[model samples]
Target: MAKGAAKGPTVASLKKVTPENLASLGVERLAELLVSVAETRPDLKRRLRMELAANQGPEHLAAEIDKRLGSLQTSRGHVVWRQKPAFVRDLDALRRLIAERLTELDPAAALDRLWLFLQTAQPVARRFRDRDRDGAVAAAYVRAAADLGRLLADQDPHLAANALIDAVAADPEPWAVWAPETLRESSAAMAAVALKAARGRLGGAAPSLAVVRALAQAAGDLDALRGSWSLQALANPSVAAALAPQFLAAGRVGEAGEILRAAAPQPTGPSGRLPPPDFAWESAWIDYLDQAGETAAAQDVRWASFERTLDVDRARSFTTRLADFDDVEAEGRAFAYAAAHTDFERGLGFLMAWPALAEAARMIAARPDDLDIDPAQAELWAAQLRRRFPAAAHRLLRAAAAAAFRRREFKLCDRLTEEADTIIL
Candidate 1:
């Protein structure tokens, strides 16, 4: 920087740079010095850069050159304007010049400055694109766009997010393709920006559906992009109104349901209570339940429009999921859940674990003398239940039904009789 420039840093300088000297240099000088050593002694520069970054964050350079130049007073009136660099007019100009010089030779330094510029200075991503289509801007934005795609996999979008996306798409590389590939600790912000862009294309006013589809394809996960779009629409009201119907029309009924469910306001404090339910909220809930295939739950809510509400169907659905559980204990628990509710009279219908449940004829003869079966027998039953779920072993349950029938215990007999064809797993 003083006159003669070295393409590679001096080995002696690498060895000579002590912590004390590093501490004494101005922030700008310190950054430049770090750059000088970066090419030849990259490992050491990396360690020092990380150290400086951890110890002194962005605030360290907030005052910058303007504040530094304040020290330039003179004894004589004609202030010999000799030593100051010609372009030290302001901090902005100085920062820009320093950044330019950094990108010219220092790869590490360029990356660091580029990160800062994109995050804090001015979204230099689009600016970089405008400035140079094929220079560092090309590779940098490609990486940025890719990283942003990973980010969209997580969050909502901003107003400026669309503009940023337009700029990214204006270039050759697609954001989704790079997101999974470009994602890294050093480039996380860029990834987040890209994700924000994905939200714009999917949720808002109909942009090219093809672009969003391509984004999904590039990210290699359509469901995740839809999830991100849902979140963004929920947070932004204008976004919600404009985009909700479009999302529904996109055959994302389930996703739209999730968004509205997530948006349904909840009471904040324990001391206070939510207002009495209105028709709108009930309708929204019913919409969510229906889309999610909780028909029983939706039906119960709908019953409020007429008379007494019985959640029998929802209870049955719950029973079904419970019986479908993998273990004997889990199946027993489902009965317990049914016990507290009306739909089931604490039915043992979920008990599919009896060994004979796999063989209809064996089940008829195997009725326990003591209703309270042994733990070992229960374990055996558990295994049988698992097999029943997978192998469709209806014979054991049929046998149990016949035994119950001969004993004049019709209810118990019917409980063992399963109609697997009737249930939709």
Candidate 2:
């Protein structure tokens, strides 16, 4: 407070060094500083040349970017992982030049340059095959390829659709990037072309099916999509199951049911047990039955699914549809069925998941021969049950710890044993 005391610098006296702040240093001084820095940093030197070219006009900028892209395309030195970050950053900078700056000045010219930029992907990719194990280089090229869609957006749809398809058909590795939704909105002719290309590339393969499905859905001709699936394709349960929901959405309920029935495993030998259930196929069939208003049939499937698989979702679906008192009765029956399932761990898991802790406790207390608990799930289930049924929780923890010991997981065994002791205490 003394009159002679010096005042400390105030907040306003300090200046952050930003472009605006640095401008006070004036152009000549800043230019000298950049020249000195550029002498040591080639990347910064290249960037400076780019900025200078851009200031001259977009044509100049386009020329500068093309030169760099050409240099990258022809080069083939292996880039180790340590150099990948800088390499990817340089590619990204070129992408921004083509996508953001050059496009604003001359769109047609930018479109040509963008295509050239994408051509560098393959060469750039080869340089890092063993190096970029994390896919950084490929991902950078994918981003650059995406700009083709934006550039083609305002062009004629027929030409645009064909150009896009041809580009993909030529280098189908980046097929997904070229799949613009706008092409789907094109005429049925374009959809037909896409379907043909899809079918031609790899017959009945999943990727081809994806292309056909997208085009057919857009054109409202799901039958064409279905027809693309060969008899061989339908023989794969997963392929048949994949098409069921699309048919359901189109209200082709009978066709949906027919395909699923045809795909279901045929009655085998004397047992007639069929192979282990394909749950994905079962779920699709249940959906189809529900859509067809086959309530009683659906209920049978749901209950059967629960009994065979001890699936909690199936049990809930089966019991939830019964009349009020009927639901309570069916629930008890389902619980009893689950308790008796052949797979003891699965049965116990179903009870615990249903939080029917009392039943779960009783089941654990019985100590079935297959009493081992899954080590991963044991800690969580034990935590939930410990307060309500300490003895049951302790039993599960001890069983899990014993299993861990058998697996030579000594640390886990010790941890679980300590947890079991705490549960009983």
Query: How well does each candidate superpose onto the true structure, as a TM-score?
Result: 0.23, 0.76
> Candidate 2, residues 1-425: lDDT per residue as tens digits?
99899997666654776676689899999999999999987777888898899899988988888889889889989888777788888888888878888888888888888778877877888898575678777676666655766676666656765665666656654554434343433455565555655555544445544555666765567788678678877866787788888889889999999888878877688987778558888989999999999988899989888888888999998888888999989888877777777777888889988868988888888764667778878888888889999988888889999999999999999999999999754
Q: Which candidate wins on lDDT? A: 2
Residue 95, model 2: lDDT of: 81
The CA lDDT at 153 in model 2 is 61
Per-model lDDT: 0.42, 0.77
- For residues 108-170, what per-residue lDDT tens digits would candidate 1 score against the true structure? 444344333333212333323234333443344344434333333333334333544654455
- For candidate 1, the lDDT comes to 0.42
Candidate 1: which stretches are off by over 4 Å? 1-41, 47-163, 170-174, 177-294, 297-317, 320-425
Candidate 1: C-alpha RMSD to true structure equals 22.7
**Model 2: clashing residue pairs?**
none
Q: RMSD for all candidates, in order, please.
A: 22.7, 5.7
Cα lDDT of candidate 2 equals 0.77
Model 2 residue 177 CA deviation (Å) reads: 7.4
